[model samples]
Target: MRTLVVYESMFGNTAAVAAAIARALGSTDAVRLELADDRPAIGDAELVIVGSPTHGFALPSRLSRRAARAQGADASATARAGVREWLGGLAAVRADSAPFAATFDVRQAPGAVGAPSHRVRRRLDGLGFRTIGEPASFRVGPTAGPLLDGELDRAAAWAEGLRGLAR
Candidate 1:
């Protein structure tokens, strides 16, 4: 199955996780990994996975969106939109089809204040997508991490589990 993995990465941690998940699904040829900044078309994909970094009790909080825009001010149009904006627009663009969806987020180790993936999952559900399973979270060693050891492998395993749903 073709899969689309879209992610927002402030410091590349989430991007790495997204890459690992895509790799887990299959070769790069089978998976399309995109940064939220890319505004990738979700067309013709059997599975769609979205991910972002947890911020201020939510996924891509307003403050983070501002920060991302500010940091990427000179970047592409989509880069300034961030995951929140991409997701806000997703329902409309994907209205024609419902794909198996999943979400992931990078956060402080267990006991963090929020799980961005949960919020993403809720939004995806509200948009009428059939969620494959519980949203997943990968831990970061620090705010700008180097994911906590083994998180990539864990992410890959999570992606592998999605195979049952993808099929």
Candidate 2:
């Protein structure tokens, strides 16, 4: 089945996690990977996966937005928009064609803080999509971080497990 992987990344950690998930699903050529900037066309995709980096305990926290603006008014290219905004604007899916949905996020370990993935899942659920597993999280090393070692492989495994559950 066709799948769409959408993500928002500040330091590329979330983007890497999204890529790993797309790869686990199948050939990169077959899966559509999108950054949150553009409104993604879900088309006939049977599965939809979304991701973002956790900022200030939420999806694109206020502080992150302020920081991005501080980077530059032209920081749109690097910071762009975030997944929360993208997901918030999604048109409601019809009941018949609503795809199986899932979400993931990248963040620091000891994950007590809230995550973007949970909010993504809730948004998908409210849009009438059926979710097939718990949201996933991949760890980053620091605030603007390279992901923790082996996290990509772990992400792949997590995606594989979710695929199994969906079947």
Candidate 3:
């Protein structure tokens, strides 16, 4: 199946997780990995995965992005709107042929509240996309981090599990 993985990263941790997930699902030829800033078309996607870093108990706001950038986040990281803005197109989804979607978010730690995955899942579901599973979260070490050791491996495993739902 053709899969699309869209991610918004403030400190690059979310980008790494998105790349790992796309790689796990298949080769680049079969999986399209895009940054939320790119505002990629959801065209022909059989499986769509969206991920972003959690902020203020939900998706990052413009103010949050600005704050992150001020705190040593790369300028490129906040160059444009992130996941919250990109997901606005959810309204364009056609119920008759919407794809299956799953959401993920990078958090400060495990069991942390305010993960954006919940809101993302709600949006996708309201827009008529069939959700194959609950949203997933990956932990990051400090605020700006190297993903807490084996998080990438765990992300890949989580992505591999999503493939089963496509069948």
Tens-digit lDDT string for candidate 2 (18-44): 988889988433689988778787788
Error of 3 at 87 (Å): 0.9
Tens-place lDDT digits, model 3, residues 28-78:
338999988888889999899999998878898899888898888999666
Q: What is the lDDT of residue 125 in candidate 1?
A: 80
Q: Model 1, residue 33: displacement in angstroms?
A: 0.6
Q: Root-mean-square deviation of each candidate, in angstroms?
A: 3.4, 2.6, 1.5
Best by lDDT: 3
User: Candidates ranked by lDDT, best first?
Assistant: 3, 2, 1
lDDT against the true structure, per candidate, is 0.79, 0.79, 0.86
Best by TM-score: 3
Point out where model 3 deviates above 4 Å.
none
Compute the lDDT for candidate 3: 0.86
Q: TM-score of the candidate numbered 1?
A: 0.84
Rank candidates by TM-score, best first.
Answer: 3, 2, 1
Which segments of candidate 1 are over 4 A away from where they belong?
65-78, 92-97
Error of 3 at 58 (Å): 1.2
Shift of residue 127 alpha carbon in model 1, Å: 1.3
Residues 1-167, model 1: lDDT tens digits:
78999998777788889989988987533788888767887888878899988777687755776675565522343245568888877753355567888999888768645788888888888887778877898988867677988999999999988877754
